[model samples]
Target: MIRLPASIRAACVLAVVSALAACANRAPTQFYTLLAPAEATPVPAESGYAIELLPVVVPEQVDVPQLVLRSGSGALQPVDTRRWAAPLGEELRTALSARLSARLGVRDVYRLASPASLPLYRVRVRVGRFDSVPADYALLDAGWSVERRDDRSVRTCDARYREDVGAGIDALVAGHQQALARLADDIAATLRRFDAGGCPDTRT
Candidate 1:
């Protein structure tokens, strides 16, 4: 039988202990995604006008795949245990597309990719702020623009929404979902007005 030297045996035992410790200390990561609102009414057929939704842009502070939370002192912290199911920007675009499609009753809502033909309206969204503070609130501040492809006319809008966060991470996510749903409602209303041939005067 061959025997290892004392130092070699000690090193092997230390390596095994280190490996076990690493496995024990590793935390399971939880992933979350934004959900679209339930459709109360059925969506209608295509309106002969399609909408091109651009990729959503988020602030650098919260652009990571991990869930970012704002502390009371305004410091941003990434929660290692909780993370986004996908890139945060892509998730926001997907959620917005679903919400807008249902709200506008249109079937031709495009995101990231567009049809060969030009769309009637091109929508772009930029999220300046998106974060949650534990037991406080979740916030979403965004600026958006809707442009008429034919006339090249554009309408810009900004919205800031906050939802109260309750006890757990689930509540925080729910708050973000609610905030996004409300923001979609506002944009949907604006799109309806544009379709009706009534665009509001540009703000000063």
Candidate 2:
């Protein structure tokens, strides 16, 4: 077997090393960025109808079924674009409390267990869909509904609101918050009706 000269072999080795160094130094193409938590602008009270929220009823399939979206095939993933916020239930509860308190002028808007709460109404939310599509750039979808315990009436048209969120958790949070804002408006409307005696008595 014929062997290459020492100088040529050294030159070839240097070329291979230089190529590897270039490859290593190249800019990364798999760009992945996580979004920061969104700041909530507190809603000011509007109607003076105080209400306390009950523990939200989340679907049974997820660990925090109240926050993440699960697929039909049982894939549990976050739909909220904001990964830094509280779980879906808690976040929704806090957001709703802020908005409702601002609109209704509730003395204390809190979870069900808060003491000294006055004439507090109960709000229940049901999530219908929440998940992400990993293919073709991650896409998030979240659906939800809210209701009052006193009347057994459903809002969200059967917990059905959908938002196509971006890949960032903050984007997801925005989407979820938007849906909740819509839901809170519906609930607030109903609460106003209740206050105005517009709701019919079902006792009959």
Candidate maximizing lDDT: 1
The predictions' CA RMSDs to the true structure, in order, are 13.7, 15.7
Please provide TM-scores, in order, for all candidate models, with all chains considered together. Answer: 0.78, 0.50
lDDT of each: 0.74, 0.45
Candidate 2 residue-wise lDDT at 30: 21
lDDT (10s digit) by residue, model 1, range 1-204:
244454553444344334434654585777999875476788766555668788999999888988776654466667666788989998988888888887776554463454547457888999999977655678999888888888898778887888876645677889999899888777777787875654443221
Task: Tally clashes: model 2.
Answer: 17
lDDT of 2 by residue, 124-182 (tens): 55554444322111222223243444455544323344555443334544565566665
- Screening candidate 1 with a backbone cut-off below 3 angstroms (N, C-alpha, C), the clashing residue pairs are none
Off by over 4 Å in 2: 1-48, 65-74, 77-84, 109-119, 132-157, 195-204
- Candidate 1 lands at a TM-score of 0.78
